[model samples]
Target: MTDALSDLARAHGVATAYTTDRGHRVDVTPDTLVAVLAACGVDAGTERAARAALEAHRSERAARLLPPCVLVRVPVGDGSGGRGASDRRAGRRGGPQDPGGTDTTPPLYLPEHTHAAVQLEHGGTVPLSPGLPPGHHTLHVRTPDGRQACAPLLAVPERLPAPARRTWGFLVQLYSVLSRRSWGMGDLGDLAELASWSGRELGAGFVQLGPLHAVEPGALPDPSPYRPSSRRFADPMHVRVEAVPEYAYLDASARPAVERLVERARQLNDSVLSGSSLIDREAVLDLKRRALRAVHDVPLSPGRAAAFAAYTEREGQGLTDHATWCALADVYGGAWRSWPAELRDPRSPAVARAREELAEAVDHHRWLAWITDEQLAAAQAAAVGAGMPVGLVHDLAVGVAPEGADAWALQRCLATGMSVGAPPDDFNPRGQDWGQPPWRPDALAAEGYRPFAELLRAGLRHAGALRVDHVMGLSRLWWVPEGRPPTEGTYVGYDRDAMLGVLALEAYRAGAGVIGEDLGTVEDGMREELAARGMLGTSVQRFEYLGGSTGRHGPLPPDQWRADCLATLTTHDLPTTAAWLSGEHVELRARLGLLTRPEAAEKAAAAAERDGWLAELARLGLLPDPGGEVAALHRFLRLTPARMLGVWLPDATGDRRPQNLPGTATVHPNWRLPVADARGRPVPLEELPRTALLRTLADVFADLEEESPHDPHDTDRAPDDTTENANANETEERHGRPGSC
Candidate 1:
């Protein structure tokens, strides 16, 4: 690539080259860089154009006194360097303090003699003070030329708030955890009941749930939660119809229709719970939408009307745009790009007229959003009120679907002709295209990260903690251009400092912990940066192996695990413990033609891995037998000094099926299977606690809690170096006796 092109790309925070997961160096093609630049509105069609754009970018940067946004890390001194007491106790370290302690926080990079003042989010406009309080502010700058400019100024706390204690929770796929009350899949009511039972009865600290972001409300709703319509709003499909208070106020005439809808819902719920079918999200939502429309017809009470108005006022334009988009989609079809030219522009006069014409439909969507928000809030309240410290930790998807509401509404901020995805790795050599649009780094900065900030704030509103799916996107994302394979994609960089600052600012305000899913070939220094900001990293037991490819494979000793993490045995994309031990995942992969190697070879490799883990469990005196390894696995997680540990809800019941298969979309039942038992019978939320298998797992966690009643974060545990040698020997023995299984 030419120096001019490189400079242009760098100016827009587009990466020119990146190291692959396999330690191979891959350079971004000049064409790819140019395409990405064009998406950012830079004309880099030729070498001359690139040079001109590069020169202009440099001149603009040099002349500007302040960036579009200025993030100032404030030292609140509430103990964890402004992160509060919970963080300090949880072993979260803050950023480096300045020498002499005058102002430890790093200074904002403003031009010399810039004469800057800050307008706080609350009310006052203060001249740049040494010790500014933590909040979002507006920075006004005056250059030497008398030119004035304003930028969004975020005064963020030094670190994020952490958990008060080392806690254990159940990691759940909410839609899979159905109850008799649910139509087909689980709803917010089921979530509340589950949280109440787990927290008050089982002494659990939190219940981590899958993303509930709005999916495309089309003929066939996408089952995957990771690809959502809008990250800023909850999916109305997850709302329990009866849970809405307005349902009670329905007129006598509407009661018969509701009763008929209830009967259909009962049949759907029974079909799913009976293990006769998968959780049909489209069917469930279709039924619920009709029922909800009937309920929406009932006039709101005076108090309810005021509450609804208050919600709309607080949500502001973002909510308005979302509802408008939904209404437009209803008329023009789901893909806004295919709509009439005038209607494609969200701000166009034609679109404004359409909004007026479809005002009722828009209001209906707004009402659905309000009701969903209320239920989600109730679920969080239930968890906290039931004695849980962290309450509910909601998951945030990495990006929005290309044809979804967010993409249509925020088209300017999202890159065109690019999809976010992963490059080739050991698991998926063909690479993976998620079909989600990448956020244009330049556009985001130009908008002062408003969209990103709003999304974070919404996710954290009713959450005690937020799990960011593919958190690496905060720093960089793999952008695969249209018509290109994932392998042809290149990494695009984001201003991590600015992004992290906004995240910390919002999280601090909400007093919620942040867990970054920092798995799969994370860049160097990323983990340290996340830890410094008090964001927890995710650690899965299967992925926490030492020297596997070198023929010396074993689980990393739990004591050696990082303290600042949420340890788990598996994730939604991975198989449950039973499947892994039984080699069900391998067989399923083979059956679906997902396995790259021969079936026997894959099975052999899987068996060797399982044997190594079991041997380690035996060496630690935790595994009494092969059948008890599941319990031993939970015990092993407790042995880790991680701040939080999560038990896969299915693992407790010995479910063999994985909730989702990463590579396969339709060949396998991805994101549709309900939480089931050893016999493959779906287990409803109401029956979960009553099951002997779940109760046994709960007892194991409870027993561990009693034995170590004090904060587990305070407990010191040394790494077991001998375990590696033992695991190596076991690997050798297993290879010698291939028939051991």
Candidate 2:
């Protein structure tokens, strides 16, 4: 059984991107699991410690394939145990400081280390060395961490970097990027321009954009950018067609309708770009799709058609199936399942009947996709034109809707009896069901993992970098069977070997770097798995802190964290720096009664944590005051030293609205809100330069430090030439640029 478990670990490690370390194979069978741990230099003492650590996670009833293997570290010697608080110091001399009270700087602990490296599958070591050690250490080890992905902490040497070696990066949301050329929302054009400017001016190495995936055009079509239709495709709304070379040759008379559609899109974009009004993403997408369709019908030369056909083949049945669904839905109805039973099974003769009936619509949908694909290629091309490295980092969502095309098309591959969700955690105690279907792990391997691989290829092909959201999902997904609440969800493990291997294979070929968003409650050793596969991890400054200490919520100390990571200030899912600074998130959630019981205490504590973090920044002299506004957030972020820094698009513009409100769908505007300029005005792309928000954001982007590991401006002799940079232009006008917002 031990040998089997080690083999299984070797064969089934979940993180497709990070399954192996030092090229050392992982054994899933129990004995090999023990062996793998030993290979990591874990001795009998460490193994005994790991077993002791694993005991607490034991289940009265074991879960097949998933036996609470994760071991939350408990401190010994010092009599401390359980995941140690990430805070730097156990006690501080001062209390929280008030932003309004004074410009007093508070004490901050920016602990770091350069010792204790992470051993990878490729035989490379990830120097996790920090300058200062937390009261206790937290290390993630594979196999050794029980089924839960948790492992016991093993301390190594602590070698801190000199203070002068530290660096900082800004964070922003892409949609919030306002530029003279952008439509209402920020597009790739805006992103390119922003990256170029930021990379060059602020000396910023990388610029992070919001998830830029293809989305449906409709009122409130799930504004949470994370829940996308197709993670592989770029959102057509981000396409800046005018920037396309073909756009210049459209016959004058033939271009009128195209131009007219652009005008309407621009008009709709205005609702988002220049006003306090919420962005109607669906309206914007609808207009852009229509416009793109016109462009597609522009009689593509044989070469273009041939290229599109090749793309169609490359996108495979999934893309084609989705296109077919869109076409059928336009005429038959919104729900494909609700469509005539004959049309339900894509491979069925009934589908054939439906296809005949909706041939034109299907063709139209396919054409739209082709144009979207072409434009995406162009956008990547633009990045290359701008001399950006790691151009167009595409974000891959966690899962797909059960009723959506993926579920409908690959029904056999998905678990019909289960949905994916989270277990009870600090933030969401009730636990949460994401309402998306989970893949049948068994089915995935049987099918040669084609579905997952194909999806990855689509996304990676056009991107210089790709981010796997909730990367831990590749290891173990919380599977809540149908009719079960999220809390009842059990863990359904994947074939981690295949998943991570395929991901590495794809990434290796694409010449793209991988970043895993390993946030929230993660299983132990998950980070180790990712690090082993040469995948970068995500580290957020705001969430970094100590446990007992104030603001000790998440991964603390940039220096203490792993080096193969993207250091960021904020995320689209979280409040922007500006919003966080103003405490608007808590207030909004409170208004909605979203806080847990004893709401007042939670609010006060949360406020205290926020203030405590600010106080620390002041102490370090990173901020002028213990509590200032958004600027303090920026300065505070600048204190962390991570190699790859990601600046959110919205943060640059000081956009207050979060791209996503995790618990709220309809209650909160969510993804519907487009980025506006300062003073709450929507600043369209064309009008971006005119807006104070855009200027400030651009100024911020320009002022960031340059030459991050993932630099956009670096033009070394050898590289992929697809990434674009600093190119805001007319194509961006489709969203609502230069007008009305």
lDDT of 2: 0.53
Colliding pairs, model 1? 98-104
- In model 1, state the lDDT of residue 79: 58
- Tell me the TM-score of each prediction against the true structure: 0.91, 0.68
lDDT of 1 by residue, 1-741 (tens): 899888777666677776655566778899888887787789999999999998887788667655666665667564555422111121111121111111222334554566677788899887776467777678787766688888776677887755557788899999999989999999999999999999988889899999999988776544788888999999999999998887888889998999899899999999999988888999998889999998999899899999999999999999999999999888878888888999888899998999999999999999999999999999999999998889899999888888889998899999998988877765556667778898887677667788889999999999999998877778778788888888788777776766777788888888898999877656555676787788888877876666533234467777666777888998887889999989998988788887778899999989998998888888888979333778888878888778888989999888999888765665777888899999899988878878876766777678344443222234374434553332222211011000000
Instruction: Quantify all predictions' global Cα lDDT against the true fold.
Output: 0.78, 0.53
Top TM-score hit: 1
Return the lDDT, model 1, position 645.
85
Q: Which ten residues in a row have the lowest lDDT in candidate 1?
A: 732-741
Question: What is the C-alpha local distance difference test score of candidate 1?
Answer: 0.78
For candidate 1, what is the TM-score?
A: 0.91
